[model samples]
Target: MILSTLDLNPVIDLTDEQFYQLCQANPEVKFERNANGTLVIMSPTGGETGNRNFEIGADFAIWNRQTQLGICFDSSTGFRLPNGAQRSPDIAWIKQSRWQALTPAQRERFPPIAPDFVLELLSPSDTLPASQTKMQEYINNGVQLGWLIERKTRTVQIYRPGKPVETLNNPSQLSGEAILPGFTLDMSLVW
Candidate 1:
């Protein structure tokens, strides 16, 4: 079930540390924090969505291992964006140099940097508008590349800084473009 902004107001606001502790305390629940300090507690995805997420993450993992281009993360990795939002994309990658710049403590907690690349796979419960807004947020927070994939519509929205959002309908695959260099996501399994 989707929790609207109105439903979140009554909940006690939490400091970043408190939110991190809460997440650690309840490892099974997925949580996100908005720029305005709204806490979002999300339910786990269904089996199909879970499987698709796994496949997508696996592809990134494999690519990272081969090229050693950067660090790759699954959905569970929380990132503290520059805009003060704590978000965890379905799949994310950070440049090695950028990741190395973080102190060990910062790396241990919610990382205080936006990923170089991010992918969000839309599940049945996810609202399209919300997801699009999130993609825009990533761009605003210094993410170089972002993909919002909608399985139901078989469409992908590509986000790049200073460029208009590009939409691809039923694409066979998606290129990482200059950001990832040679990494391509095969959509055959994704769709």
Candidate 2:
């Protein structure tokens, strides 16, 4: 995706509601907000990216369904991070307890909570540094685990709190570890 950022600072600092309204008004567009209130617009994915995203989401959904561990969100689901940024990871999951703690109202709109796990797939228009920065943002905002997958290079960068990122090359699969027990992402499907 070709991600664009627009700074609406000093001129128009949109509140959470206004941002949500803008997104609702333009459902065809995907928007994200940085901690500085800059809006990031994401272009729609091409066939390869879309199909890969779907496959990743399906695996996550299936795992969640079987475990009844938490809720799974696709790319369209926006989350209000603790640091005042709005993000929509390619695939996200929240622990069941954490999800159940939210009020119905909170659940209806962008839930003001960081997901326990997040995944971002590098698209054709994406750069390594940009994707790495986004993944770091997730970690700083209290995400327990994250993966940045680059199909072109067949590599995966793993993120975790208080640790340096772990990079894997052509790994057969990924284990969710204790964070998502028994969940293994089959790299064959992704690669």
| Local accuracy by lDDT, each model | 0.90, 0.94
lDDT minimum window of 10 residues, candidate 2: 1-10
* lDDT by residue (tens digit), candidate 1, 1-191: 24544235467767789889989998987888889888777767888889999998888888889989899988899999998999999989999999999999999999999999999998888999999999999999999999999999999999999999999999999999988988999998788
Best by lDDT: 2
- After best superposition, candidate 1 residue 108: deviation in angstroms? 0.8
lDDT of 1 at 45: 81
Q: Superposing all C-alpha atoms, what RMSD in Å does each candidate have to the true structure?
A: 1.7, 0.8
Q: What are the models' TM-scores? A: 0.94, 0.98
- Report the Cα lDDT for residue 149, model 1: 94
The CA lDDT at 21 in model 1 is: 99
Query: CA shift at 9, candidate 2, in angstroms?
Result: 1.0
